[model samples]
Target chain A: MNETADTMNVPRSRAWTLFGVFAFVALIAAQVHAVLTSPADRDMGHLQKILYVHVPAAWIMSLAFLVVFVFSIRYMWRGQEKDDLLAAAAAEVGATFNGLTLVLGMIWGKPAWGAWWVWDPRVTTTLVLFMIFVGYLALRSFVDDPERRAQWSAAVGAFGAINVPIVYMSVRWWRTLHQIQSSPSTMDSAYVLGLRTNAIAFMLIMIYFIRRRYELARLRRATELIADAAALGGT
Target chain B: MNAESSLAVDAQRIARRFGARWCLRGVSLQVRPGEVVGLAGANGSGKTTFLRVLSTLLKPNAGAARVYGHDVTRAADDVRRHVGFLAHTAGLYDDLTALENLRFAAEMLGRSPEGLEASLDRVGLARVANDRVRGFSAGMQRRLALARLMLMHPRLLLLDEPYANLDAAGIDIMNAVITEVRNAGGAALLVLHELAPAAGMLDRVLTLVDGRIAAEGDGPAANAPTASAPTLASAAGAR
Candidate 1:
C-alpha cells in the first residue's frame, strides 16, 4: 500500500552483473569438479556431465514458476499492480529457463536412455509445465487494459499454478516411467555443493531478469496511460 | 414519516488527481438516505473518477469520503462491504450462465446458496438460468448484472452509466430496481448524460464540469433558466 515510483527502479544492472559473474565462475568450477572428483559412469560415459547444467537449471525454472504463483495470488488478493507485474516478469524468465531445461534434459536423455524423447513422468510433467506457461504468456498478450489484464492474468496464473503440484506429484504417485528422485539425495557432498551453488547463481540471474522486466512493464504502463490521457484531452 | 433526514454518505473537499491533472477538486456533497442523486457530466468530466474514489476502487489524493460512517481509505474493505459498484463493464463473467454469474457473485458476497436462487428470480433471469452468458444479449447480461446487484443489497450504490447502451426494456427494469433501492433507504450516485430522462427518478441533480461541481442540490434546475453556464466559483461554492 505504501509503494512509490522509486521502488520500481532497483539496480537491475548491478544484480545482473553480479549474477553473471557468479554463474560464469560456477560453470568453470562445476566442470573442474566433475573432471577431478568423479569418473564418468561406464554406462552413460561423458554424457552424464550435462547433469551439472540440466539439474540446476531445472530447479531454478521450478523456483521461478513458484514465484509466479505467489506473486499472482498476492496481486489478486491485494490488487497491487506491482505484484501482477512481478508475476508476469517471473513467468517469462521461468519459461525461458524451463525451455532451456527441457532442451538440455533431452540432450542428456538421448544417449543415456537411448532415445531423444520419452514419455517419462519428469520429462512429460516438465513439458506440460512449459505449455502452461506458454498459455499464460499468450493470455497476457491477448488482453489490452492494464487492470483487466492484471485481473485475467492473475486468474490464469492461479489456475495454471495448480498444475505445478500435480506435475510434481504425478512422478511420485503413479510413476508413468520417469527416473525416481535419485539426483537430489544421492549426490556426493562436493557434487551437491557445486549443484547448490549453480542453483543460487541461477536464482540471482532470475531476480535480475524479473527486476528488469518489471521496469519495462512500468515504462509500458506509463506510456499507455500517457497516451490515454493525451487522447482524453491535451492542449 | 421522514427517513430522508439522515445523511447516508458524506464527502468533504474530496480531491483526486491523475499525475498533473485533477479529476476531482474540492468536491463536497451529502447523500441522504432514501434519496437518489444523479451525477451529470460531459465526457471526461471526472464522474467516473469521482465514483471510483468513492467506491474505494481508486484512492483519493486528498480529503475524505465516508459511507455510513466507514472511511473510504482507512477502512476500504468495510467501505466495499457496504458499497456495490457497477462500472461501465458490468463486472460479469461472460463465460458463465446468468445463474452461474449471480451465484459466483453471491458466493463472493458470502450469501447463502438459497439466496442465490431467489436473487436470480428477483432480477428476472430465472427463465434464462440455464443459458450461458456467452450467448446472452446485452439486455440479458444487464439483467444478470442486476441480479448480481440484488445479491449484495448494498447500502451505497455506485453505478457508472448503468443505463447506457441498454434497450428501452433494460432501462425500464433498471429504473424500477434503482427506485426500489432508494425507497428501501439506500443512497445512490448515478452517473448519466441525459438527466431529463432519469430526472423523474432522481431526488437531486449534480453537474460536474472541469473536475468541480458546476451546480447541485434539491430537484432539477427549476429557477435557473440558463444554469448551463454557471461560473466555476459559484459551482465550487455549492453546499
Candidate 2:
C-alpha cells in the first residue's frame, strides 16, 4: 500500500517536456517565415497573413474534436477511465482552438465583410460548436462522481461530434458568406508552404496541450479515488 | 475444487494506500460458502475499502482478490454478476416510487419484474409501493434497498454499515436477509462500527487495525475477536 500504485500518477517524462520546448520553437519559426515570405494577397494584402494562424487553428480545432469523438466512443464501448480522461483532455483543447478560430475569423471578417460579426451559416455553426464543447467542459465541472461525469461527458461529446461535420460543410450546404475551405490546389503556391507549415506547428502545440491536460486529469482521478477510499472512515 | 472456487471470497495480501498513508496493508481473508462474516473496525480502519475492493468498486494498490471463482480485477463483470453491494448510501432515485425503483433495478440486473410486489412486501415496503422514495424516511429507504437485494439474489453481499440508520425492526429485517443469504447457500460480509447488534448471527469476525487483519473471531462468540490466524499471520509478516 505504501508503493505508488499507478504509473499514470508518474510525472510527465523529460522527453515530452523537451517536445513542448521544440513545439513552441517550431511554432515561432513557422509563423515568422509565413508572415515574411508570403506575397500579399491581390485583394486582401497584409490581411492574408492572418490565414496562417486562422486556417490552421480551424483545422486543429476540428482535429481535436475528432479526437474527442474517437475517444468518447472508445470510453463508451470500453468503460476505461483513461479513454474518458483522454476525451476530456481533447475537449478542453478543442474548445480553446474553437475559440481561437472564431476570434480570428471575426478579426478577418471585420475588414473583409465590413462587420466584426455576422450570422453567416459557417460562422453561426462554428460558434455553436464552440458553445457545445464549452458546455461539455462545464458539464464535467458540475459532476462530482467520476463514473457519472464520464458517462455525461460522453453524451455531450456525441452531440458535439455530430456538429463538427456540419460546421465543415456549412459553406456547401447552406451557401453562406463564409468561403469554402482552402487547399493547396485552390490557393496560390507561395501561400501553401506557409499554411502547411503552420498546420504542423499548430498540431504539435495541440498535442502538447492535450497531453498536459490528460496528465492533470489522471492525477485528479487518483485523488478522487483516494478520497473515495478514505470515505466511510478509511484508515 | 480449488480453494478459491470453494470459498465465497479469496483475498490474497490485498493492500491500498492514500498518498503516504497505508490504508489496507497486505490484508488477506477467506470466507467459505453459506457463511456470514462481520468486519469490525474503528473509524478510518479500511473496512469499507476492503469491501469496495471485493465489490469491484475500487482496485487494490497491491495484491489480488477473487469473488467466488472470478478474479476481481480481470473478470470484474463476472464477479459483479454474483455480488450484491450495498454502500452506505441507499443508491436510490428519490423521484422514483418504491415499486418503480425495484422495477428499474430488476431491469438493470436483467431480472424479470414479476413478483416485484412480493419483493417489496418482504421488506415491508409494499404498503408504500407507489410512494416516491424522497418521501420515505431513512429506515424506509434502507428497506427499499434491501428489497432490491432480494431481486438480485446475488451469491455474495458486501454490505457497508448495514445496521446504520435502522430501527429495531429494521435490524431484524436485515438479520433475516443475512439468514436468507445463508439459507440460499450464498455468503455475506458485513462492515460494522459496533459488533453487538449483529453478534449472534455472524459466523466469523475479522478486526482491522491500521489496515491489517490483526485479529479473527469465531461464530457467535466472534464478538470477542482474537489475534490473526496462521494465513494472515504470514501476510502480516510479509508487510
Top DockQ: which candidate number? Answer: 2
Badly placed stretches (over 4 Å) of model 1 are A11-23, A28-41, A70-84, A143-162, A171-204, A210-235, B1-7, B11-29, B32-36, B44-65, B71-188, B197-204, B210-226, B229-239
All models, RMSD in angstroms: 7.9, 6.8
lDDT of candidate 2 at residue A115, scale 0 to 100: 79
Alpha-carbon deviation at A128 in model 2, angstroms:
3.1
Model 1: pairs clashing at backbone N, Cα or C within 3 Å:
none
Worst 10 residues of 1 chain B by lDDT: B230-239
Provide the clashing-pair count of each candidate structure. Answer: 0, 2
Q: Report how closely model 1 matches the true complex, as a DockQ value.
A: 0.04
**After superposition, which runs of candidate 2 have C-alpha atoms over 4 Å from their true positions?**
A1-32, A71-94, A139-159, A167-190, A204-235, B13-26, B56-63, B86-137, B165-170, B224-239
What does fnat come to for each candidate? Answer: 0.00, 0.15
Instruction: Estimate, for each residue in B116-213, the C-alpha lDDT of model 1 and write its tens digit.
Output: 76667766777888788888776677777877876788878888877766777678878888887888888888887655446477778788887778
Number of the top-ranking candidate, with TM-score as the measure: 2
| Model 1, residue A98: C-alpha shift (Å) | 0.8
